[model samples]
Target: MSALILFDFDGTLADTAPDLAAAANRQRTRKGLEPMAYEALRPVASQGARGLLRVALGLRPGDPDYEPTRLQFLEDYAAGSTVHSKLFPGIEALLSDIRRRGLSWGIVTNKVTYLTLPIVEYLDLTRESAVLVCGDTTAHSKPHPLPLQHAAREAGFSVERCVYVGDDLRDIQAAHAAGMPAVAAAYGYVGEDDNITTWEAETCAHSSTELWSAIEPLLPSDLR
Candidate 1:
């Protein structure tokens, strides 16, 4: 059977932090909080809304403004989702390869549905993705297997015949919990000190080119 490749959106395939960081700063400015630098927010791109809220608004879990602040951030982000977002270098080539090889591909991200749709569309990925499982699509998000498992099922692939690639530890955790082989995207938003080697990844691809090289062999020889 052919292997199905499931990719994480924010850090793995796209650089969406610029728009997200801009939204975070906008929220901060409205709240009279100091704006944070874009670089500072990059690492948390895959961490989702709450993490950005914490960095930009400084809202604790119990803070009364937290929910409202998060809502505002989401609204602003939706408007500016693709302002600066783009696929990583070599990603187009890799995606082209996947399609040319007739391999199934899909996205499973912790990004909420509304925001995720715009970004995916902006990247022109709508026609290419075979399945999509957003953060709110399932009851639970990453670090939980339900989303990935559900995505695999919907894609008509067994979990064992699939491979999930993502940048964060939680991505690895979720893939493992879902009974799929996981790969760490080393070229993603990972910090220098973050130890991806410790995770139970099938392998780590340091760049989109490297990811292509690694996965090409796993595909059928005719496809390769």
Candidate 2:
């Protein structure tokens, strides 16, 4: 077992916003509603269908149409998984550096496996990641710590030696709840209302270079 660096997929590791925004717009078109601007949907991309539904369709969980619309949104998203999904700048180099440092890294995401696995494969990370844990991998997901804990266990890392990096507030909550440190990816899809500075993260990486600097020290020096 070694020190582990785990990431949330959507905004943190990969920029899936383009495809998500497209899916949201597709839903709007189906509903005969005007498409929402991409800028408006980008911030909520990390929140998945619920967020998109709220923004593009204005459908809340309380509405009868919420569940069906959410399902349709997911369906549309799955159909366009890799169309515009790509890792953020410097991510490939970061992964290479992590490998060179002899540390282990993986993805722990709220995205379901059916949707996430294909994207991971398309990104050619299926062979690179030490482990890949999705929303359904455990009984519960983020904020409950099950997903992060599952990733650590599967990756053969100790809770104390694990660091979770993510773009959303729930990521910080989950890592801390699991007794692990969390790094906030400030360069990611941080919403207009979110305050990364106050997320109680170990550190907030405002850019990929900053992320590398912040993460390098958290990794065991021996591994580096």
Candidate 3:
């Protein structure tokens, strides 16, 4: 079977933090709070709504207003899905490299279909990605193995033939659980406290360029 490259949507494959942070800041503004700086909200971008709400409004899942805040955040994010979103630098080259090798790539994200679909379409990735497993696509999300396993299966790869790349610790955890090698995208929304190297990924890439270099050696001889 061909090797499959599965990437996390928000941070690894694409930089969606600017828009996600804006959505969180919008929520803060509605509550009479000041807008948070993009850098301040960036690290939480990988965590989705839960992280954004906490950073901007200090709301947790159990809070009475949390659900309303979350709904609003989703609405705000959708309205500006493409504002500052773009594939990470060097990613285009990396993807082209993968395509030239005749291998396959897909996305497995905690982003729900509502959010994931628009970004995927906006970025024109719909045609190129062989398979997509959104947050809601499976009953469980990462750090559960289900999403990665589901995407790999859809991509016609055994878990052992897959390599999952992401910016979060959960990504590595899930990859290991699914018996796939994990590559950490340290260039992405890594938290201030996160030690990317400690996640025990097969490799840690500090930038898109580094990521490609790190992953290239891992591909089998035929694909390389």
Q: Which one wins by lDDT: 1 or 3? A: 3
lDDT per residue for candidate 3 within 1-224, as digits (tens), equals 47888999889989999999999999988989889889999999999999999988889999999998999999999999899999998888888778777888999998899888988998888888889999999999999999999998888888877788999999999999999888999999998899877899999888878877788666666666
State the weakest 10-residue window (summed lDDT) of model 3: 215-224
List of clashing residue pairs for candidate 2: none
State the lDDT of candidate 2 residue by residue for 1-224, as single tens digits. 36889999999899999999999999999989888899999999999998888988888998999998888989999999899999998998998888877778899999999999999999998877999999998899888888888888888887888888999999999999998888999988988788888899988898865777877666655655
Cα lDDT, model 2, residue 192: 78
How does model 3 score by TM-score?
0.96
Arrange candidates by TM-score, highest first: which order?
3, 2, 1
Candidate 2 segments exceeding 4 Å error: 221-224
Model 3 misplaced stretches (Cα beyond 4 Å): 221-224
Indicate the residue-level lDDT of 150 in model 1. 96
Count of backbone collisions in candidate 2: 0
TM-scores for all candidates: the values are 0.92, 0.96, 0.96
**Global lDDT of model 1:** 0.85
State the lDDT at 172 in candidate 2: 95
